[model samples]
Target: MAYHRRYSRPGTNRTPTCDKISEILGSADKLAGEYSFGGRADTLPPTPGLFVNGVGMILLPLVSEHAKKLIAKCRQSRDRPNMDMGKSWLQSDQVEMKNPSWQAGMEKLMKNIARGTGYMDIHFTACLTN
Candidate 1:
């Protein structure tokens, strides 16, 4: 079976764990030839060594490891390999964000909250509630 893990702080879930995300991405990398995967979350397809039908998301314990890499991949043109990864994320609704600045701000806040101690529940308030 495919590994489905969530990397978050010991008792908090604000930022995404990038390292863990990277590991997951690496694992998923093993599966890049089996399934016709496509999207930001679809980093790698199931291959001979990788498992099939195994997919997951990273959004806790730490910032998403692939966050930067994914973003970089997203920014890449379609000519590049895996360049469409970002597009898949958007098509899959995994990234339901329209504004880049807004998303960046939210990511920054999540990182800060994850690092420090504060009631930073983004869902509770409409705006910054720290």
Candidate 2:
């Protein structure tokens, strides 16, 4: 008989927490590289211990902690239904047409068009036709 280990249930949906942690760590590594000696080969220290301590001890753990907190927050939000805001403009497929700023801009544009052309209504109708 063989023994196997299973961390999660067969049908449970598990979030890729390790992947998120890896991604955060990867980004921190990239930033460390960029800021350290401008990623130059000659400027790098002779000992690998410097990078190991600076990145492994400091950056990786910091980023991992932040990632875990963010993941927890996301899970919490996902577990609850959003009840704050009204329907998004994308969901409703509608926008406010009576905004004061929009009306003012339209009026200014109409004045400019009317000044350029002799008639405002005719030019506006022609623009709509086009």
- Best candidate according to TM-score: 2
Query: How do the residues 22-99 of candidate 1 rate in per-residue lDDT, one tens digit apiece?
Result: 567667634433333233432222221211121234343335664554454333334554753444332233333233
Q: C-alpha displacement of 36 in model 1, angstroms?
A: 44
Off by over 4 Å in 2: 1-93, 97-99, 120-130
Q: What is the C-alpha RMSD of each candidate to the true structure, in Å?
A: 22.4, 28.7
lDDT of 1 at 12: 67
lDDT, residue 8, candidate 1: 55
**TM-score between candidate 1 and the true structure:** 0.18
Per residue, candidate 2 scores C-alpha lDDT tens digits across 41-128 of 3322223221121122223334676444433433223323473532211211121333345445555555555545445345452121
lDDT score, candidate 2, position 25: 59
Using all chains and alpha carbons, the TM-scores for the candidates as numbered come to 0.18, 0.20
Best by lDDT: 1
Clashes of 2: 0
